[model samples]
Target: EDQVTQSPEALRLQEGESSSLNCSYTVSGLRGLFWYRQDPGKGPEFLFTLYSAGEEKEKERLKATLTKKESFLHITAPKPEDSATYLCAVQAYSNNDMRFGAGTRLTVKP
Candidate 1:
């Protein structure tokens, strides 16, 4: 079975503070790792797709990196606007559907 677990279900940071969210997973065979951000009453917005270990993608103050067993979403000097629920998912080569983590809720205070 494939499963994902995200730590620190919630986070609070002062404006301009930096932190990282963790996503750990276990799969039969990793096809891809995906990162997304979701806002209240809105669907998740795609952030990055990691195809293999050691691969990374970045946008603005956010960076997503992947490894053999886990992935990390790094937030740098985040502002209030950066606050949202960050989601992580993984697809296994043997399965067509993706398994997702519970998501990490981040609040950046101004």
Candidate 2:
């Protein structure tokens, strides 16, 4: 069976501080992306993807990388407005829906 486990459930960082969020998975033939929800009533915004093992993608202050066993989302010098719920997901070749982690709720304080 495949699974996705995200660590630290939540994180708090001061403005201009840096940190990384983790998402571990057990799926083979991985294909999915990182998404972020800015508010409770908003939809998740697509941030980036991990098409293959060892692949990495970046957007603005964020960087995402995928490996055989896990993925990481690195944030560099985030501001308070960067606070959001970051999610990770993966899907094998045979599945129609991707498996998602619970999500890491990050709070960047000014």
Candidate 3:
């Protein structure tokens, strides 16, 4: 059975603090891994698309990396505006279906 799980369901950080969030997943015939950020009541904004192990992508203060069975989103010196729910989704090749993690809620306070 394929599944996705994110650790530290919630995180609180002071402005300018740095941290990393984890997304663990298991899938048959992996196709890609996606990272997204969603603000309250809003649709998720795409952050990255990782196609294979050792792939990585970055935008502003966020960096996403992927391996065979897991992915990580690293935030460097985040600001209050960075607060949001981070989501990870995986697509499998066989069915072209995507499974999403519960998400990690991050709060950056000043």
Candidate 4:
């Protein structure tokens, strides 16, 4: 079975502050790792996909990096608009099942 754990269940930040969210996992065989952002009452929006260790992706103020044991979503110069829940999910090479973490809720105050 695949397992995923995220750190800092909640975070509070000031506008323009930078921080990172962590996602750790244990899987039989990793196929891909994904990051997403979700706002209240809305579906998650896809952020990045990491296929292998050392891979990284970036969009706007968000940068995602992956390692063999974990993945990180780095938020740089965040604003109030960046406040949301970040999700991390992993897919295994063995099956179509995807495992997800509890998520990290970030609050950026302006």
User: How good is model 3 by TM-score?
Assistant: 0.97
TM-score of each: 0.98, 0.92, 0.97, 0.98
C-alpha RMSD between model 4 and the true structure: 0.6
lDDT of 2 at 86: 88
Clash number for every model? 0, 0, 0, 0
- Kindly list the per-residue Cα lDDT of model 4 for residues 4-72, writing each as its tens digit: 999999999999989999999999889999998999999999999999999999999999999999999
Clashes of 3: 0
Model 2 reaches what TM-score against the true structure?
Answer: 0.92
Winner of 2 and 3 under TM-score: 3
Per-residue CA lDDT of model 2 for 22-92, tens digit only, reads 99988766666455555667977778877777889888999998878888999999999889898888878
Candidate 1 lDDT over residue span 1-110, tens digit each: 89999987999999999999999999998999999899999999999999999998999999999899899999999999999999999999997998999999999999
- Residue pairs clashing in model 1 are none
Each candidate's lDDT (Cα)?
Answer: 0.95, 0.84, 0.94, 0.95
Model 4 residue runs over 4 Å out of place are: none
Error of 1 at 64 (Å): 0.7
Which candidate would rank higher by TM-score, 1 or 3? Answer: 1
Can you rank all candidates by TM-score, best first? 1, 4, 3, 2
* 1-110: candidate 3 lDDT, tens digit per residue: 77999988999999998999999999998889999999999999998999999988999999999999899999999999999999999998888678999999999999
